[model samples]
Target: MTRKHIDCRSFPSEINCSIAISADTDRELLEAAVQHAVAVHGHHDTPELRNQLRGAIMDGPPTEEQPAR
Candidate 1:
């Protein structure tokens, strides 16, 4: 199965978070990304936010180096 990833640095945020999360499935990646967003980025948990996070997910292993954001 292909791994999925969500790179925080790829998104535009005030904090410019550099954290990246990866998982075996889109569901798992979304869950971890949501937790990181809430705990570290101070974003509130909401359906809309969840949808947005889901949309941001990418296909591949998490990269060690940050891509151009």
Candidate 2:
């Protein structure tokens, strides 16, 4: 299966985050994304946030060109 990842540049953020979180498994990716969201994005870890992060996961790595925000 394709690797999963969450790229900060994939979404529009006030901070214009450029980080990308990737893992071989969904559990690992979600946890890492949660930590980054909490630590760097100053977001509280909530079920809703988790759902949002889960939804943001993509089937591949970050692209050289970010999608238009």
Candidate 3:
């Protein structure tokens, strides 16, 4: 099965976080993303937040980076 990943850089945030999380299953990815969001992003954990994180998950590897601005 293809792995899933979520890149903080792909999402627009006030902090412009660059963390990336990946896993073999959706559940694993969600768990890691939630932890990072709470610990690093100062986001409160909740059912709605989990759903949003799950929605943000992307299939396969992350996209290639463009040159820095």
Lowest lDDT 10-mer window, candidate 1? Answer: 60-69
TM-score per model over all chains: 0.85, 0.87, 0.85
Q: Which residue pairs overlap in candidate 2's backbone? A: none
Clashes of each: 0, 0, 0
In model 3, where is the ten-residue run with the lowest total lDDT?
60-69
Tens digits of per-residue lDDT for model 3, 29-59? 9999999999988889999889988888888
Off by more than 4 A, model 1: 64-69
Estimate candidate 3's alpha-carbon lDDT, on a 0 to 1 scale: 0.84
Angstrom error at residue 5, model 2: 0.6
Over 1-69, each residue of candidate 2 has an lDDT whose tens digit, in order, gives 688898888777799999988898889999999999899988999999999989888888667777554
Best by TM-score: 2
Instruction: Pick out the ten consecutive residues of candidate 2 with the lowest summed lDDT.
Output: 60-69
For candidate 1, the lDDT comes to 0.87
lDDT of each: 0.87, 0.87, 0.84
